[model samples]
Target: MRGLVESAEIVVADGMPLVWASRLARAPLPERVTGADLIWSLSELAASRGWPIYLLGGPPGVAARAAGQLVERHPELVVCGVDAPPYGFDACDGGREKVRRKVVEAGPRLVFVGLGFPRQDRLIAELRRELPDAWFVGCGAAIAFAAGTVRRAPAWMRRSGLEWAFRLVSEPGRLARRYLVHDLPFAAALLTSTLLHRLTTAGPPFQQPPS
Candidate 1:
């Protein structure tokens, strides 16, 4: 996963914690740029430019619903295809090839994949080989959010960087361990390390010579 991200054409800070870490490191980023927001903005650009797009992932029928929403918003947008592959579809070579062929045949200019993390990113890498001219985004749950199958945090929560709390409350059973046990500790450690690095590298306090 690290190699894949490092090799990607571009990467952005998708969470506020990452943005904060950048500031602590003295290399501040503009802001978080989330996939949930990108789906709309990118579709708008694709519409204006006449770039056909493909939607992949989410539960059955969700990709289609998201496609509908995008088209409704941008009447000029063309959704070339939508696919919601079965669970573990990428587990076998045959299944991966099947979806790869489907997307290539559709010949979209852009592809939004919402299969989550390394899986979606891995598939995007493979699909890029078959459709070298196409652009791909590993969009996580953006498709479901666009389709209204999953509710996104309110705008205020998102702006305030409390969106994770909203999601944790909404899906405690699925997310509690990830948020509390794994992510929380990792975030704390990251901030701590950044602060330590900054402090250690900082020069000594200025002293005025006797006047």
Candidate 2:
């Protein structure tokens, strides 16, 4: 995780909990920069600039559907390609290499990768070798959200920082342990520690006059 964070050119707070944690720590980042929002904004910029974009990842057919929708929304946008590799494809024979070749062939200025985590980030790193000028985004579930295969939390729930709860309810089988057992408590502890550290360091230290 540290390697991933260190390697990324930009690391934005994606969820409200992370946004809250930053505020509690007094760093006060501007906003929650969700992948879905980034997709929309980047697509708009691409449309205006006439830059082509590549879509890779999400469930089979999802990224392709998202690409169609993006073109529909931004008529001027250029979607060079879309692909959804099978599960564990990254580990299979020449799977990542094959995708790399496709992306290289497309010669897009931007690549939106929805494969999630280490795989998505790793793929971006590999692709960066050949597509040095291309910008890449690791978009987690955003492609599915764009394709409407999955629904995002409502604005109220998102702003309330209960999007995790909404997602747990929406996909309990998939997200129950992840939110209940892992993320929630972990975020709480992290927020508490950050707040405590901020309080401890808030004021200037007393300076005794020289003897």
lDDT of each: 0.92, 0.87
Best-matching candidate per lDDT = 1
Across 90-119, the per-residue lDDT of candidate 1 in tens digits comes to 889999999999999999999999998889
The digit string of per-residue lDDT tens for model 2 on 80-183 reads 99889889888875987788899999999999999878789988888888999999999888899888899999999888888788889999998898888988
* Model number with the top TM-score: 1
lDDT of 1 at 98: 92
Q: Which stretches of candidate 1 lie over 4 Å from their true place?
A: 203-211
- What's model 1's TM-score? 0.94
- Give per-model TM-scores: 0.94, 0.92
